[model samples]
Target: MRIRSDGLAARSFDAETVVLDLEKSQYLTLNETGSLLYELLRQERTMDELVDAVVAEYNVDRVIAMRDVEAFVGSLREHGLLTGSDVLA
Candidate 1:
């Protein structure tokens, strides 16, 4: 599936990512890994692509990378960062 990041004003600082949801009036801060993942999510990507991105950027194991990416996506979904339309095949 592909993820979308609409209605967000995001900025990256060093290894951190900050996003402000104009509609929700909420903001989120992400660490190094999260920042990279967030950047990737701006484009359409499969789950594997997300994992591969983390693995390539960091020296983490494949399993750990996948787990972290999944967790991050889950958090993003839970926070309403990605909407139903943002998710597509």
Candidate 2:
């Protein structure tokens, strides 16, 4: 899934990312891996694709990467930051 086009603004600072949810008037911060994933989430991506990216970038195991990606996407969804058919509820 991709980031929502409306009511969300983000900036990257080195390995970190900060997101502002205008609709919710809340701020979210992302760590290094999350920042990378956030950039990829600018475009549509599948769960597998996201996991693959985490694995490739961090050299983490597939299972751990999948788990982390799931959690990250969950956080984004909870904050209404993602928009796409592939986005999980």
Candidate 3:
């Protein structure tokens, strides 16, 4: 459960989605749920906490939220948007 902030920029659109530009090198388009999850990631929440947050915010099952968050986090890491450490520092 690592989150990196370096070379990553995010913008919310219509309060319905989030557009994340990573390293000015690639982009990730997230829906309402993803946007919410991203916001929580910014706060450096743990994996369990993140899953709980997602479940509370959306009408999805815990299993589904956990899977989705895992996938999303993987993608963010692959894009170098997340560094396995506090990115703000």
For each candidate in turn, the TM-score is: 0.84, 0.92, 0.75
**Global fold similarity of model 3 (TM-score):** 0.75
Ranking by lDDT: 2, 1, 3
Q: How accurate locally is residue 78 in candidate 2, as Cα lDDT from 0 to 100?
A: 85
User: What lDDT does each candidate get?
Assistant: 0.78, 0.87, 0.70
Quote model 2's TM-score.
0.92
Candidate 1 all-Cα RMSD: 2.8
Note the clash tally of each candidate: 0, 0, 0
Cand. 2 Cα-lDDT: 0.87
Off by over 4 Å in 2: 87-89
- Predicted candidate 1 versus true structure: per-residue lDDT over 1-89, tens digit per residue: 33445677988888898999888899999999888877877776777888888888887899998788878888988888764432313
lDDT of 3 by residue, 25-54 (tens): 667787777777777777666777777888
Question: What is the Å distance of residue 55 in model 1 from its true position?
Answer: 1.0
Give the better candidate number (2 or 3) by TM-score: 2
Number of the predicted model whose TM-score against the real structure is largest: 2
Error of 2 at 17 (Å): 0.6
